[model samples]
Each structure stands twice: as structure tokens, then as C-alpha cells.
Target chain A: MIEILKQGWHTTIQDLGRLGSQSFGVPISGAMDLNAFQWANKLLNNNSSAACLEMTSKGPELKFHEPSFIAFTGAIMQAFLNSKPVKMYKPIEVKKGDVLKFSSVTLGCRTYMAILGGFQSEKVLGCRSQYKGVTLEDRIVKENLLLFNRNAFTQKGARVKTKTTDYKDVNLKVYQGPEYHLLNSHSQNEFKTKQFTISPSNNRMGYRLNEKILQQLPEIWTAPTLPGTVQLTPDGTLIILMRDAQVTGGYSRILQLSDNALNLLAQKSTKDVIKFELITL
Target chain B: MNNKLPFTFFRMHPKVILLEWEQDPSTETLKELTHFKANILKYSMGVSQITLGYCSLLVQWKEDIINYSDAKKNLIALYSNLSINSTPAKTKHWTLPVCYEGEFALDLAHLSSELKLSKDTIIELHSKTIYTVYFIGFLPGFLYLDGLDSKLFFPRKKNPRLVIPKGAVAIGGKQTGIYPNESPGGWHIIGNTPISLFNTKNETPCFAKSGDTLSFYAVDEAEYQKIQCVNNPKAYLTKVK
Candidate 1:
């Protein structure tokens, strides 16, 4: 068992999200960044679907109750083990009594902390993901004992570099949705041409982009917005629905990002400029 | 563009066809569109899922089995056959139990004051009316029902609370919904339900599906416990029609 020594901002346990039900209004609450989560688990040689800790914007501090192997990926928060600085995106060894701490983050909004064996929680609806609203527990604070299988994975001990794919400069691919042509050709051209910055209010629910796509096309009706769905609000703002986003939205969906493009948005930090790319005809 | 006239569409997605009835759609139009989607799912193209909302039905399919061209042809054929008088083959009806008192309904008092009605009257008004499950979205098993009495309608909270417990029955604008699993929400919560809106262990996780009819029944604390604790499927005496 590993113990939480410090609780960071909005850290929670997440897996591939609760799927199998969308008609009932459940948003898939899984790892926001699939690539980062898979990579973190891969370092520990754990299953890709294993539940891991998700630290948002900032990270928390944990103390090992016993010897354990762990890895940190995604957001590059200055990490330290036992007061000595540790590298991001690589597995590190910690003995009993060693404390792991994270300072301010410089890039991205979320980080993944994966142990050799995934963390354990009381499963709800077959999912152990901590949806703060549903589970009633907000934060995993000090003295919280998180359990995992002791002998889950064989110790490789060899460190692997976290794959840092450059998506910041890449053009995000988008498919035309039902409301695509609702925006006249002028607005559609503007949407494809212009770059937009992620608004500061962005979180798991959705990312509100600071753009003027809405100024061109205004009329819309209530429609089901899927994950990766780009909704254009009346005020020219873009709300990109995330993992924990509402199952349905009322905004006109001008563009629906391909599943691949959604991976890029998960790593995007506030103020990072991103451009959209149309899928090849 | 004519304000009242519905815009026609030959195509929406690569395969999917758009059939619009009105800009601000009426319940009659939504029901008709849902029937059209249901008809398409029955014979040709096994559309994996069909999502019905206020004004549209999103039909998702397995692109591997059916290409865009075939899907477009089948969709237009189905749309032309649809008529305004068509009714769904089957409609699911549900009567959920609600404990609308004390901490269970934290926002009840505020809602009563805003709507200028007593808490009991609010409960009476809420339970007396039958609601249509217009759509299911926002969360799993979270049914968005229409037909709330206009007197009870209110705007969502400006600043949403961090957490609202599961089974919280809330109202926002003209729509009423029960939060299956708690997340940040701005709905006016007037009651609590003992029935689990979503249970992943079951074949169908969401208790109420689209095109289902929902009614609320008032209950006390003891009754709430009996219903909440009963995990056995057989113990749920309420028949889902």
C-alpha cells in the first residue's frame, strides 16, 4: 500500500472511463490522455486499462509505505524523490519512507502516475474511477492508504524514456458534423484558417476556446454532443467536450475532431495556440 | 432562408442523412424523427446506436460493414416514407420513488421561493404531472424529460456546486432530470430518488431510456431506506412498462 502525503489540485483515479452506457447519460470518465496513460502503464508493465492516478494542473505528494516502482508521465511537473530531483516520463524506484513530491507544472494540464500494480478503489458500476460528483470523495488527502496487488508485475528495473510526441505544432484533424454547413462558407473558412487559444476555464468537462467562430453562424438546436465534438456557442466561443463532458449539448457542432486529434487536446496547455486540419477528401 | 420553413438536406455525414422538421422542433416532430430512425434500424443498415435529442436523431453506424454511399441511399428512402402521425412501436414507462424532504432536497427551499410556491405544493405540482423522456444525455442514465409544469421552471445556478449526489432529481429551464452519478451541476434539485438511474452491472445501465415515460412518487425517509437498500432485482416491485 502507498500513502498519500499531499493532495494536489483535482487529482483523481481514472481508467479508460466507464463505457457500455451512453444512452443513460453517463460520460466516459477515463484517462483524459489515452496516449499518456498507456505509456505510463507500459513503463510499469501493467495492463493498458489499469487504473492510475490523474493529477491535474498540479500534482500531489505520496510516501511509499513499502518498496515500490512508479512512473510519472504527461504534464512535466518538477518531480522529486526523497528531496532529490527525479526525471519526468521515466520509472523511478522508491523504498519504504521515501517521499515523492511535485512542484509547479510548466506544460500541459494533466499528469499520470502509474505504479507497478494499479491503485485499488471500491468499484462503482464496475468502474473504480473516482468521479468526484458520483463517488462523494473529492480528493485523496493525507494518510489515505491506496491498495494494489503486491505481486502484479515482474520488476524490469530498466528505465524507459517517456515518448514525447510533438502535437503542439500539428494540425488537428476534424470531420464535418451535422451542423457543419449551418455555418456559411465564410465562417467555415475562418474556422479552418484561424488559430485558437485554449481558455483558462478549461477542465475535464470541456475546453472553451477563445475564438470567434460563433460570430458567423448563430442558429442551432439541441443535439447530442459526443466526445471530441466541437460545439460553436452563440458568442463565437468553441467548447470542446472532454472525457467527463455532458453526454448531450445544445450548441451547434460545426466540427467533430477525429479520435486521434482528441489526444492532442488533452496535452494542450492554457495559452497554447492550435490550428485545425480537415481530413483529406 | 425562410424562418419557419425546415431546411432540407441530401447529406449530413459521409453516410448519414439530415431530416429536419422545424428550427425549434415540437415534440410531435421529434417523435416522428425517432420513428424514422427506428424504422431504418429495423430493416436495412444496422445502425449501432440512435440518439434522440430535442430536434435531431444522431444515427451511428459501423463504417466497416456499410459504406457511405449505401447508407445515404437507404436513409433518404426511409426519410421519404416517414409520416407525421407515426408512433413508436413500444414506449417504456417508469414510476420512480422520491424522498423530497430535508437534506435530501437541499435546493428545494430556494426553488420554492423562486417559483413562489410552498414546498408541498411544489412536490404536488411535480408529482402530479406525467413526463415524456425527450432525450437521455448529459450523463449516463440521466434522462432529460419534457412536460414540467411551467410554474416550476427556473434557470440553472450561476455557479454550480462542486458535487451533487447520485439520484438527485433536478430541474433546469423547462427540462427535468435525475442525476444518475453526481458531478458539478447547476440544476434546481427538488427531490431525491431511491432508484438507481444507472447500474453498469445490468444489461442496460441507464434505468430510463429515450421514449420512456417517467412519473415521480413521493415517499418518506423509512420508505427511502427500504428502496435504496434493496439490491435484489426481484425486490423492485415497480413494473417498467
Candidate 2:
């Protein structure tokens, strides 16, 4: 068991996410950065679907109750165990009552921490990822206890240097969505030329990009949408649906990000400039 | 039935394939979608999911696609050749209860005055028609039901409510639906249902499927209370033969 001394912002227990339920209108509320989440699990030799704690901006301060292996990934945050400095991307051992603390950093927007056996959070609709309506609580609150297999951590794994994701890169590769042709010719060209900044109105659901794509085209009949779908609203706001995005939408789906691009975009904070590099399927 | 399987396919993502129809939302489009979905699920090699929509289907494959054209070609061929529709044409019809009295009818009076219809008449029109569940979105179990009477068709609120209570049944443009859970909604609330539309404990969270048909029946405040306390609201759900 891990006891949370201080809760992190938008902290939630997430795995790869809930799939096969989108047919019933459930959002795939998974980790924002899949590469990092999967890497953290890989470092601990845990199952890929093992639940990990995902936090945005600030991370949590927790007290470990048993000897276990853990890993931190995504953001290059300054983390400490018993006030001793710990490095990211490396699996570290923690004894009973060892306090782990994380300091806020501006380098990345989201972070993932994986335990030895994975978090045993409540699973709903075949996922451990927390969301409103589906789960009893949406976030990991302060003083809450997280369940995990005590003392099940194996031998310390070799430190892995990150390679899958480039956090600093803002150029996200995208594909033309189902309704991409709906955009006027001039507006369609704007994606290649214009650099969109992440707006303040961003969350787990979506990232509302700065600047209007166009005076929105007519609404399409409600269609199935996915994470990384860039929707154009009536007012012309270009919002990129994230992992927590709804399954269906009525807005014009103008562009779609590849799974890798979506993971890259997750690291960006508000006001970060990004360019859409259109790629042929 | 859509002859020759009228659909335009697209490689939307590395793992996602989109099959879209040109027509507007209709029972015919739904029938075709339902038929194709059932077949795709049966023949899934790595197809993870096939999500339903008004006029399209988003098919997601578990593995990344090495050849988009080949996958699209195969799906097109599969739909065109499968003529024997194993899926039953007749859909399950349900009659759900709603209470339009007091606070449950948040926008009833305003909608009545705006549409130039009495409150009772408005309720009559809403409850009379059987609505098609085009898809569920916005919130979990929030059905995107079509078939609102032209008379009750009103635009969504200019300013959406901060919090719309769960079970709030409302109309927004040509659509009418019940909110399965509490959410911030812009639709005009005409009534509320005490019976839960979604429960996580059940194997199937929402009883209403995409192809299913449903209608609302007005219930009194007393009856709403009696039905609200029960653990399983499915017991109260009436099946229309």
C-alpha cells in the first residue's frame, strides 16, 4: 500500500485504457503519454496494462508501506526518496516507510509513475483509468491509500535511456480526417503554414488549440470519434480530442493525430506552439 | 437494405478505418450499420472495436496497419458480398417513464411559451413518438435520440447550464434525450426520469443499444419516488411488443 501525503493535480489511476466500451459511448480515458506510461511499466517488468498513477504539472508525495520497485518517467522532474535524489527513467527500490516526493517542473505537462506489480485501483468497464460517472472518484485525493501487491517487486532492472518520444518537439504529424475536405481550400492550407498554440481550456478530454480553423462548416450527423481527432466547432475553434475524449461527436473532424503524435502532444503545456505536419496515409 | 454496400472508406489513422455513408440519419442507414458491424465483429482478425454512429462506423484494428489500401479493399469486399443479413430486422422497443412535474420540468414552461404549445400538449407530442437511438455520446449513456416532433424542435440554450441534473430529459434542435448522469448540458430540460438509464454493475451499462427504439411515458411524482428507490430499474422498463 502507498499512502498519499499530498495529492497531485488531475492525478488518476490509468492503464492502457478502456477499450471495447466505446461502442456504448465510453471515452478511452487512458494515460496521456502512452510511450512514457508503457516505458515505466517496462522498466519495472510489469504488465503493459498494469495501472499507474498519472499526474499533470505537479506530482504526489507518497509513503511506501513495503519493499517494492518503482519507476518514474515522462517529465524530467526532480524526485526524491527519503530526501535522497532519484533520477527519472531508472527503477529504484523503496523500503517500508520510505517517503517519495516530487517537485513541480516546467519541462513536461504530464508524468507517469509505475509500481512493481502495478496499482490495484478499482477497475470499471474493464479499465483502471478513472473518469466521472464510471468511477466512484475521478482523481487520487490526498490521504487516500492505493493498493498494490506488497513486496512483489523483482530485481532492479537496468536503466533505460528514453528513445520512443521526443518531448521538446512540437511538430505533430496528422492525417486528413473523415471530413477534412469540408474545409475551404484556403483554410485547408492554413494548417501547414500556421502554428497553433495550446489554449488554456485544455484538459484530459481535449486540448483547445489557439486560432480558429474556419467559420465552422455545417455540423455532420453524429459520428464515432477517437482520441487525436481534431474537431472544428461552430465558432471555428480547433480542439484536439485527447485520451478522455467522447466516442461520438457532431463537430467537423478536420484532422487526426497518429498515436505517437498524440503522445508527443501530451507533453506540451498551455501556450506551447505546435505545427501540424500533414502526412499521407 | 443498401444494395452494393454504399459506403466510402478512409484510412483515418494507423489503426483506425472509417466507413461513411453520404445520406443523413435514418432507420435505413442504421440497419446497414448494424448489419455490417455484426459481420465485422464475427470476422475480426485484429479488429478491436466497431463504434456506431448516425451515418458512419469507426472500425479500430488492434495492430497498426502496414497496408491501408488492402485493408480498405478487404472491408469493402466483405460488406458488398455479405448478402445474408443474419441480424434481425426487428429492434427491441422500450417504454421508459418520466416525470414532467415540478423541478424535473426545468425548461417546460419556457419551452411551452416559446413553441406556442401548452405544457400538457408538449408532453403528449414528446411521449407519442418512438425515437431511434442513433448513438450514445457527450456523456456515458447519454443517448443521441432522433425523432423529436417538429413542433417541439427548439434550438439549444444560448447559455448552457452549469450543471444539468441526471435523468433530465430535454430537447435541443431536432433531438431529444435523457441525461443518464449529471453533466453540464445546453439542451432544454422538459422532464426527468427517476429510473437510472445506466448502472456500471450491470454487464450492459445502458439498456438502450444503438439500433434499439424507445419512447417516453409521463409518470406522477408519487410513482417516480416508488421506482427511484429500487436497485434494479430494469424491472420497471416496459418492453413494447
Candidate 3:
């Protein structure tokens, strides 16, 4: 058992999201950065689908009740185990009664912490991801007792690390969306050349992009939308749907981001300038 | 643009493909889309998730490493191999109860004054029509219902309310929906439903499906409280046909 000594900003348990529930209008609530989420599990040799604690902006302080193993990845947050500093993307061992604390983050906006056998939580719709009405609680609060399986298997000593990203000058890769044909010829050419900034109105659902493009496209019939679908509103604002995005929408889907691009964009925050590089299929 | 194919398939992502119909959206088109969506899920294997909307169907695979070309071809093959006139699952007509008195009917006065209709007329017209459940979106259990009475048509709020209370049945333009969860919305709240539209504890979180039909019946505040107090509010559902 792990005790949550401190509550952080937007801390929630997420897996690959509540799958197979789109027909019911449930948002697929999952990790923002899938790359980091998978790596944390790989480091500890845990199941790839293991649930992890996703922390945004700030991180929580956790106290372990038993000997456990953990791996931290994403956003490069400052962390410590009993006053000694620890690095990200490494499997760290904790003795009983050890308190782990995490501070502010840089180079990104979100972080992931994966335990050895994964965090055990009530599964709603076959996923451990948390959502407002779908789950009992939207976030993990202070004084919340977290349950994790105590594994007996020992990890084979293996070295693994990925270069930390600065998230600067990175291009958000994309493909033309279903409604790409609706864009005028001039608008299509100009969209690629223009650089956009991430607006402050960004969250788990979507990132609203700044700077309007000159497209007066009418709303399409409500259609199915996914995490990486880039929708252009009538006023030309670009709204890129994220992990917790609704199942359907009524806007022009102009572009679809690659999985890798979605992961990279998750690290970005408001005011960050980004350019979309279209990878034609 | 492709006249030969009845529907066009676009690769939304490496592991996701969107099959969209060429026909304009209508009740008939929705029926066709429903048939196609069901068959794709039934015929295909290894499909993780499949969802349908106004005129399109999204098919997602379980495995990450998918050859998009093969997957798209398989989807296309599945579409052409079968006849489109397969029997669809029967749709349900749900007669849900709603209270229009006091706090529940926040916008009824404004609607009556704006549309020049009486408050009683507004409530009567809204409940009279059997609205079609076009699809569910925007929020969980928030049904995208159609067939709102034109007499009660009103534009959405210019500045949307930051928090529209859950179960607040409202109308916006030609569409009407219940705010299954408290959310920021522009729809005018005309009434509140006692029946819980969504409950995660239930095996099927939402009782209604895309092809289902819904209608609201006026209930007194006393009855609303009675139903709400019941541990299983959905048990009161009158599924007509």
C-alpha cells in the first residue's frame, strides 16, 4: 500500500483509457504522453497496460508502506527519495516507510510515475483511467491510499535510458484529415507555412491553437473524432483533440496527428510555438 | 468524389480508419450507417473499438503495428462483400419523466417571452414530440436528440452558462438534449429529468443507443423527488416499444 502524502495538480490514474465505450459517449481518458507512459512500465518490466499516476505542472508526494520498485518518466520533474535526489527513467527501490516527493517540472508540462506491478484501481469500462462522471473520483487526492501488487520477481540488471527532450523547435507531424478537401487551395498552401502558438485554454480534452487561419468552413455533420484529430472551428481556430476528448464533434477535421507527434505535443504548454509538418500518406 | 464507391475510407491514424457515407445525413442515411457499422464490427476480427456518428463510422484495431493498406482493404472488402440490407437491432422508445416547475425550468420564462409562446405551451410542445436519438456526444450520456418542435425553436445562449446543472433538459436551435452531467453549455434549460441518464455503476452506463427514441413527460416536483430518491431511478423507465 502506498499513501498519498501530498496532492499534486491534475494527478489521475490512467491506462490506455476507457476503451470500447465511445458508443456510449464516454471520453477515452488516458495518459497525455503515451511514449513516457510506456517507457516507465518498460523500465520496471511491468505490464505495458499497467496504470500510472500522471502529474501535470506539479507532482505529488507519496509514502510507501512496503518495499516497492518504481520508475519515473516524462516532463523531467525534480524528485527525491528521503531527501536524496533521483533521476527520471530509472527503476528506484524504496524500503518500507520511505517518503517520495516530487517538485516543479521543466522542459515539459506532464509527468508519469509507474510502479512495479502497476497501480491497482477499480476498472470502469475495462480501463483504470479516471474521468469526471465515469469514475468514482476524477483525481487522486491527498490521504488517498493507493493499492499496488507486491511482486516477488526480481528485475534483471539492465541499463536503459532515452535522451531527454527540450521540446523546443519540434515539428508536430500530421496527415490530412477527412475534411481536408474542404479547404480552399490557397488556405491549404498557407496552412503549412504558418506557425501556430498553443493557447492558454488547453487541457486533457484538447489544445486550442492561437492565430486564426482564413477558412470559413461550415460545420460538418457531427462525426467521430479521436485523440489526434485536429479540428478547425468556423472562426479558424485549431483545436487538437487529446486523450480525454469526446467521442464525436461538429467541426472541420483538417488534420490528424501521428502517435509520435501526439506524445511530443503533450509535453508542450501554453505560448509554445509549433509548426505542423504534413506527412502525406 | 469517387462515384464508384458508396463510401470513402480515410486513414485517421495509422491504427484508425474512418468510413464515411456519400449520401446526405437523414433518418434513412443514419439507418444505413447503423447497418454498416454493425456489420463491420461483426464481420471483422481484432477490432478494438468501433463508433458511428451522423454519417461516418470509425474503426480502431487492437494492435498498434497495423499495415494501414491491408486494414483499409479489409474494411473495404467487408463493406462490398455483404448486402447493406441486414436486419438492424430493434430501437427503443423511452418515455422519460421531467419536472418543469420552479428551479428546473430556468429558461422557460425567457423562452416564452422571446418566442411569444406561453410557458405552458413551451413545456407541452417539448414533451409532445418523440425525438430521435441521432447520436451521443459532447458529454457522456448527453444524447444528441432531433425532432424538436419548431414553435419552441430558440437560438443558443449568446454567452453560454459556465455550469448547466446535470439532468437539465434544454433546447438550442432545432436540437434538444439533456445535460447528463453538469457542464458548460449554451443550451437553454427548460426542464429537469428525474431519471439518471448516466450511471457508471450500471453495466450499460447509458441506457439509450443511437437508434433509440426519447420523449419527456411532464411530472410534478413531488414526483421528481420521489423518483430521484429511489436508489434505482432507471428502474422507473417506461420502455414503450
Give the least accurate 10-residue stretch of model 2 chain B, judged by summed lDDT: B81-90
Per-residue CA lDDT of candidate 3, range A1-281, in tens? 98998888879998988888888899987999988898888888888899999999898888999888888998978999998999888888889999998889877989999988899988898899988888888899775789998863456654576766556746989999999989998888876898888999999989999888787999988899999899999888989999999999999999999988899899998999889999976
Per-residue lDDT of candidate 1, residues B1-241 (tens digit): 1123343543433434445555576656656665776686776655665666677666665453346566667766666655532446566667778999888999999988888899999899898888888777876667778889998889999899899888898888877888877677988888898888767677666655566677888999898999888844334335555
Q: Tens digits of per-residue lDDT for model 1 on A1-281? A: 87877788878888877654455666667888888888898888887788888888788888888787788888778888988999867777778889888887777767889887788776766677776545546456665687777666656775566668565555788887767867777787887798888888788878888776645565456666667888887777888888888767877777877766787788786788888887732
RMSD of each: 5.6, 1.6, 2.6
For every model in order, the fraction of real contacts preserved is: 0.64, 0.87, 0.81
Per TM-score, what order, best first?
2, 3, 1
Between prediction 1 and prediction 3, which has the larger TM-score?
A: 3
Q: Which stretches of candidate 1 lie over 4 Å from their true place?
A: A136-139, A155-163, A167-170, A214-221, B1-52, B55-91, B97-125, B149-171, B179-205, B217-241
lDDT of model 3, residue A211:
84
DockQ of each: 0.42, 0.85, 0.76
lDDT of each: 0.74, 0.86, 0.85
Give the lDDT of residue A20 in candidate 2. Answer: 88
Worst 10 residues of 3 chain B by lDDT: B1-10
